[model samples]
Target: MVPTMVLVADGTRDTRRKEALHDLAEAVADRREAPVQAAFGSPTELRAAVESIEGPLVVVPAFLAGSDAASTELLAGLDLDSRFDACATAPLGAVPSIVAQLVTRLHAEGWRPGDGVVLAADGGPELPGNSERRQVIDVARMLSRRVQTPVQVGYLHAWAPSVSDAVARLRRNGHDRVAVATWQLVDGADLHRLREIGATAVTAPFGPSPVVIDTLLAQHRAATARLAA
Candidate 1:
């Protein structure tokens, strides 16, 4: 059997918030036939969760790329040579799996062939070419070719051509209706930024699409399989 592992998150105490994490954990566990332990709450809780699972383990962050202090500490603890043979996967940025999910969400939301899709991320000089921004660009470029829509890149924080700028340009170019597919997992900072830019239609993290769940599970399974090998 695959060695025991745990999924750790800083965790929101809100029941609604835990629902998504629990669902993804269960899906990954089912696919790999490995027991999964969830550790949520304070740093102590997270540490305990990591300790519970024996042997080599992986830390899969639910967050997008950012300078999260708590997350940084957790990663530092796991990155040490001893303790665990830990590898940190990029926090669900614009990996192929996520891009596929986003594209599907666009289609489900009635985005027509000519609709403009702007891939927006938390871009700023502070986080220039950060993992999240890079992944969004990659996803948008690939999606542009696949969807035949004008996919543009914009940033909410530190990057140029902000969503407002993109929107103005798109409107000026006669693309009146634009859909902002937030390249973010959950609605918080990124969502707020989207609102600030006056995004009328914003796609949900993964849009409640079944494929998003499956893609996340596949990522978990593939990561575990690589570790086992």
Candidate 2:
């Protein structure tokens, strides 16, 4: 029997959101050996899609991992209806494996264990006062503690000391050649901006590694397996 799999995500940006959704869907389909349907829309639209679908639903955030107000809103809306058994997986940015990939990227970029580095994210304080920007800080703190480097949280848009600002600060503090690890899933505007600032840019493991496909596939398989259990 073929299990029903519905891939849904918050579709704010017409291009990037759609690409992330389908990229995830294709990855899931390839792994589950089942048919997967993709849905791209706002939170309201996603809730409606879930209500209409007869199979298991996996809601994946296009943004990095960690919970935010918008994500909380979506989850709250879903909780209003208990007709379906659904589970929201971690955002692509929060997967534990992502940390490992990031460490590898840093090492490859010549960042030793004690090198002062900044894990810069595109998220800013601008999205909303309670956006997921804090996740960046959380990740940076965790990584910094693990690697024994001083990592400070900053944003590219909504927060203080943007990546460039952070870079300048690091340089002024005598840490030259600061490695700017991009917390983006795919290469786009933010990546371009990082390059423009002359920061030594490094993408998250998913952005340049094939393991991203494997991770998406595993997420879907886990979702389906849970439903079956």
lDDT of 2 by residue, 1-229 (tens): 4445555454554465357556766766666566666655677777676677675566544445432233334443454246446665555654556766777788877776545687777552233334355566778877776678887554666557677888888888987667876676654445566677776555442442556656765676787676668
Candidate 1 C-alpha error for residue 210, in Å:
4.3
| Residue range 1-229, candidate 1, lDDT tens digits | 5545466555553454456556666666666555667654567777677766667666666544431324434544553355545555555555565677777777776677777778776554433234555666777787787788778877765567887888777777877678787765444444655767754467766532455446555556677777777
Candidate 2 accuracy as lDDT: 0.60
State each model's CA lDDT, in order.
0.61, 0.60
TM-score of each: 0.73, 0.72
- Model 1 has an lDDT value of 0.61
Off by over 4 Å in 1: 8-19, 30-32, 39-45, 63-80, 93-97, 124-130, 187-196, 207-210
The residue-level lDDT of candidate 1 at 183 comes to 69
Q: How many residue pairs clash in model 1?
A: 4
